[model samples]
Target chain A: MYLAKIYVTYKPSILDPQGVVIKSALERLDYQGIESVTQGKYFQVQLSGADEAAVAKEVEAFVEALLINHNTETYTYDLTEI
Target chain B: MYLAKIYVTYKPSILDPQGVVIKSALERLDYQGIESVTQGKYFQVQLSGADEAAVAKEVEAFVEALLINHNTETYTYDLTEI
Candidate 1:
């Protein structure tokens, strides 16, 4: 088995209202100087019977096919042996 | 100015109920074989007059001080010149 860690975040040019809410929450809690907040998804996938390079390719394709909307979000991944 | 991207996540062993909710959501959206979902926070901070290494140290300290609950969460960062 291998561990595939993926991070998905909105494009820099996009407006993120949820991020805004979180930023305000942090500020209210006295976390000063926090200029912005961005909400994103982190996923840890367990792979079976796949090599690292192949898995990376497949995962990227998978995201492009179904997981992420490439128009609005971008994703990156780190694959590690388990 | 520098951009400090921070990711705060729960310890692996902890029970992630919100993650579970998201997992169910994905499944309902036809995302198959998603074993689990883990929720986390992502923040993009604009720093003033702090070098990469110094900003890293201070940000780590800031997370320890206010952002994360060390007992339940762990954090990491990537600093980039912007």
Candidate 2:
């Protein structure tokens, strides 16, 4: 099986309330010098295939088609054999 | 400055509806051979510190204190100079 480690985050133009909340939470917790916090979704997908190049292409297409909403978010992922 | 690439995923015991939905969506799109989907939060934290070891220690403490809830999710992070 192949494991895809995906990281998806909001575009710079988009407002991320979750990130904002996390920033404030850090401030409240006395974690000084936190320059910034940008948050997104991370996923681990297990694919039942063996062909490396073919799987990478399919995964990219899959990401572009369903995993990312280009209107607000951007995503990047890596596939590794496991 | 240092950049901490953090990934926080739900505990295996927790129910992940979002992942379930994504799997269904992928299946609907005919992306066959997807064994499973698991989702979590990813963050890139910019910290205003120079010392690598001290920064890593602080980042760990920061993650434990505010970035992760010991109740339902687990987190792992990497600190890189940036």
Candidate 3:
């Protein structure tokens, strides 16, 4: 089996209001020296396949098709054997 | 400056409905060999501090105080100089 750790984040040009809100909240709570915050989505997926190559291929296809909005976000993944 | 890559995830004992939904959706879409799915929150935080150790200490305190629910979620972070 292979495990894929995927992260999907907004493009650099995209404005992340949630992140802005979080930063403000942290400041309000008296957390100092916080420059910025960016929020993203993380997923861990387990797949059973014949080999690492095949499993990685499947993960890439499924992640692109179902996990993210290609127009606004980009995704990266690390596949590890389990 | 430091970049803290943080991840907040539900405890293993907790049931993740969102993950279940995603797995079902993937199956419906004919994606195979899916064993399980777990969804989590990711954050990239920029902090300015005198040193790595100090920044890490601040991150730990703030993350524990605000980023996660102690009963259901757990968090881990990687701090890197930027």
Estimate, for each residue in A1-82, the C-alpha lDDT of model 1 and write its tens digit: 5676778889989887877876676677665456656777766666554466776775676567655788899888788877
Q: Please report the TM-score between candidate 2 and the true structure.
A: 0.92
Screening candidate 1 with a backbone cut-off below 3 angstroms (N, C-alpha, C), the clashing residue pairs are none
- Winning candidate number (lDDT): 3
Candidate 3 TM-score versus the reference = 0.96
Per residue, candidate 1 scores C-alpha lDDT tens digits across B1-82 of 6777778888988887877775676666665445555667666766554466776776676667766888898878888877
lDDT of 2 by residue, A1-82 (tens): 8999999999999998888898899988898789989999898889988898888888888888988888999988899999
Identify the runs in model 1 with alpha carbons over 4 angstroms from their true place: A21-36, A69-71, B18-39, B64-66, B69-71
Candidate 3 global lDDT? 0.93
lDDT per residue as tens, model 3, A3-57: 8999999999999888999999999999999999999999999998878888988
Ranking by lDDT: 3, 2, 1
Query: Clashes in model 3: which pairs?
Result: none
For all predictions, the C-alpha RMSD in Å is 4.2, 1.5, 1.1
Clashes of each: 0, 0, 0
Error of 2 at B72 (Å): 1.4
lDDT of each residue in B1-82, candidate 2, tens digit only: 9999999998999988888999999999999899999889898889998799988898889888777889999988988888
Tell how far residue A60 is off in model 1, in angstroms.
2.1
For candidate 1, give the lDDT: 0.71
Alpha-carbon interface RMSD for all candidates, in angstroms: 3.7, 1.0, 0.8
Which ten residues in a row are the worst by lDDT in model 3 chain B?
B48-57
